[model samples]
Target chain A: MNPPLSRRDVLRRLGFVAGMWWAARAEARDIPGDSVYQLRAQLTDQDGRSFELSSLRGQAVLVSMFYSSCEQVCPMIFETIRLTLLALPVADRERVRVMMISFDPARDSVAVLKATAEAHQCDARWALLRAEDAEVRRIAAVLGVQYRRLASGEFNHSSAIELLDTEGRIAARTGTLGAADPGFVKAVRKALSRQA
Target chain B: MALEIVRRATRIVVCAAAACGTAMAADFITVPGGRFASVLPQGPVPTVSVPVEVAAFAMRATPVTAGEFLAFVRAHPEWQRGRAPAIFADRRYLVDWRSPVLLADGGAADRPVINVSWFAARAYCESERARLPTWLEWEYTAAADETRRDARADPQWRRRILSWYERPATTSPPRVGGAPNVFGVSDLHGVVWEWVDDFNALFIAGDSRVQGDPDTAKFCGAGALSVIDRDSYAVLMRIALLSSLSAADTTGSLGFRCVRPGGERP
Candidate 1:
């Protein structure tokens, strides 16, 4: 807003400005709960309750998004999670929780999530939670879940297993939704190791 | 007195042995493997209408060998070897053909072939003037074993199949089990899924009889009685299972055994 700065003044400020831009660009996503970290968002879930992204504060949360009706990738994803969990020694399984969030609010109700859970025969440790439309989208955006519905009422979404450490910052993510085998397993293992 | 006694004993023994052999042949198929249900598909045998004529001979034992399927593949060039179609792989690549078909101990030609497709198989059968045995014909043979105590039934069969499933992946050749059926068929199971004609012809809708049930209404339809010999608990599996995959499909699992028509069995 001021008159054009003198050549000396502009030159004098360039390094400082350049340094601040670099710092911002290279900023590490905060490991939440740290003083340097700030909670950026929150959402209300189906139970009329709210799940603050910050709630996954301390444990490594592997959040997976899926709808009950998926035919192609859901089963593989479920099995991958199963193998990953089973690959963990029983002791390690106790520390980790695989949170499966349902993305299709129109049809994926609580009952549907439970049915899907049963269909896969997942054990009690796996939590299948369904959120309302707004909450699903908001939380999905918060977690960077990329998803779109196909014409068949099925979803063509990224089958990514997102790793959030106890502090609730994204630790790592990998695997296309269609990976047939334990690609997600590799990602989860890498993330857990990173956390350690 | 010694010669008279020997002659008398020999006649008795010969008569008894012949009777035993006859009884055994009448009860040819062996149900050595699963406690799982057998299918009693009774649909129209478009190819072989005369039921129980043993229109097709069952495999003496399951075929979990590469040699067996290789014969089928070699005979049928039209069947795309690696990319067997989706209709064959259950709409997914469940069959990993490249994984391994050879057994740990090596090969057995007599073993039934696994990891083959209906398309490849149909060609093989056609070349020989024999087609894949319909589900009904297979059931007819299996029932003989079921009734005569010639076959191991129930709990034992279940264990046998499960055991095959648990075998090391590297141990490709399916182990042989279950005595041969009357027609000299071997290892019908405890190896891989056998192919049958008219698989999806009779669908098992959950509430088939109900208004909401699928069109055929459960396992009891016009086609139901045709496919099933009786409503045995295990038979439902064959009737209900829809494994009609296309030729381009390849699976680590799944294979087939060849059958010759009654008049055709060599």
Candidate 2:
């Protein structure tokens, strides 16, 4: 049998329960109608950490879709994103998160994602994620990216980087690559400002 | 143990009585696949168009009906008219339904369900252990008529399909179970526009004449060139309409059916 609880013990248990309740409430709160987080997508990151896409809520994010194998344009995609980050102010850059979800999840294992992350020097603020094929399509659909697998096993895809506000609504999108789109950077700054 | 037995018995009774509300099991007919020349080629254009090989698969005999969708929404309440998240569906989703789970009166139950977003259609298909047919598969299946498998070359057949597109949408769509094609599939034409699984992937250049524009670089790695099969305007129009739509955008005239794996060549 368990011992009768003291007043301090009772208070401690109540605090624990209240904390749990608060956390659950925060998770259960209605996501904004337009938020992409409503998809409930499951993703595994570069480090093999699995999490729901909604967990990235409450932050400004730069989202794009790509497959790691493409030697020509995909590399430029990473560089363009890096250049975009460089154009941001230090504070805003630190505040922003980058998400690159892979279109070719059949080939992009967690190890490949980690290798790509290390090669690209993706920092803690960056998440290179891989999801199943169907989920990948849904993610690409929401982000307005289009891709088709060719007979040569190569992917023909449109490149568009989407900026998301704290609530996961697309704030801005640009197809510009190989250099930063100043307008897109300005929009990112605006999103972060709204968060402040 | 006794409680578990009671619960199992109750579920069986509900299903047996049809009180649980489920659509009749979809009729999946096997479609023998082969090499076919699609209007939208898989290869980059200006290069000689190569025929894409389609694998054998099973497809539903008709578009999912209002009664079927009513049963789907009833089983999965989250996909009901108002309750589905805005990210997956739009305000117009299932607007024709009298309520979340009820089909409107006057034989609307047999009519093909429309105003469904791609995401909702995909979810409904997944619940049935199936998926939306790919564009190539749908095109191949629709190419058949009552007698010949590839009837696109027949002028009269093309005219019939084109005429359906020419007609204005009625207040209510016609029911499923139209006369079957050679493959035993129905409602491929003279019905609501269906959603293909890779509808978003059918991207074509907005204007092929835009030379030396940096914006054209938006598409990477052998972007789609001029459509070679210009004679297939009906098919081209379908591609245009599909590519223009976002996944969440539902329309009164859009619906979908599902497909599953079928016999292998071996």
Candidate 3:
């Protein structure tokens, strides 16, 4: 019978294995410790273009989660974003992008997302996105957005707009709706001005 | 010298094979799903109560052990303690482990793996072709005792479960196997707080919006969870704890299990 392996020997072997694995895989650039972009969630936009959430890096982004069917606060989220952007200078607003991900991917298809975008008059800078249920959950988790599907087919969700800095770090968040949150707008302006 | 080199190479190969071979051998017991009266309402209105329809699923009979997690990190090096991204896990993640791939001692292997972030737990489950159980599924399965499937109604049973919460924290918890519930699951309580797939979805009781409270204004749409059963203090405490955590946050007493779909409904 073979001799029993010691802890040192096992660790040595494991270290070698790990070393080989890391060597074989190309190391990606380091994202900030607090950056939400570290979450590699696959998302599809209103245009049906599939992209990773991290691809939105290099721009101050306003991110939120809402289902298109939500009549009350979901629409208000769009209006609030618009109002928040309006509060910023046009140049700063041009640099800032909005990412609205739907937690209800089952019903929020590409066509549905596009229509919602049109209804909200969302321009090219705004991305109305949908992801798989698990991905949606992870995105929500990272953004601190809470949402759950109800029996009535409507979603019971927290409406918080998170501001991701140029590096995708959460710089500011606001849950106020029906109008722009002044503090959140100030944070957005600060984020954009810093990036500028 | 040649013979010694050959033995070392042979040992490495054998050790690698053994670790990879046993990684996926966890025991999964089926918990039949049905209409469950969850503490958190399934409606937009916090006060209104509704039953959630949970599908049948298979769950790990016990929480993921440290030994099992060691094998997992060996297979998927990206999820190792130091290698995992900071956005996915906080500094306390897997802090108890002596090394990224080694448990502190032999006894550490059998103890339920704690200080694991929700993201890390979810990754481990994904590697096994399973996912973390939903809050509803976990609550439903945990409501069972050794004899009855829904022993939550009994005051003595509630007290017994609550006592686990009251006990002082043990730095070295015992091995995972305990009395199995009606679903053949063990250590759902008195072991560790677990990570649910929808942990972030659990809105807290304090999320109730007040007219002038700025912090309360942070949530839209009946975001607060109005507890339907206040008597289930143990279960309600679990909800509160889970609702308070972020995806990257990990605590010493928190661990998790995985669940697969298509379990036979009883």
Quote the positional error of residue B19 for candidate 2 in Å. 7.9
In CAPRI terms, model 1 is classed as incorrect
- Candidate 2 residue B207 Cα shift, in angstroms, is 5.5
Candidate 3 residue lDDT tens string, A16-68: 99998785453235577678877878889999999777777777899988888
TM-score of B chain for each model?
0.54, 0.88, 0.86
**Models sorted by TM-score, best on top:** 2, 3, 1
Q: Lowest summed lDDT over 10 consecutive residues: which window, candidate 3 chain B?
A: B207-216
DockQ of 2: 0.60
lDDT of 1 by residue, A169-193 (tens): 5666656333423555555555566
Q: Which ten residues in a row have the lowest lDDT in candidate 1 chain B?
A: B214-223
Question: What are the lDDT figures for the candidates, one per model?
Answer: 0.49, 0.85, 0.84
Ranking by DockQ: 2, 3, 1
DockQ of every predicted complex: 0.01, 0.60, 0.37
Estimate, for each residue in B206-259, the C-alpha lDDT of model 2 and write its tens digit: 665542332435766666544557788788889899988999989989999999
> Alpha-carbon error at B217 in model 3, in Å?
4.7
Q: Candidate 3's residue-wise lDDT over B185-256, tens digit each?
A: 999999999999999878766533432332334555544566777789999899989988989999999999
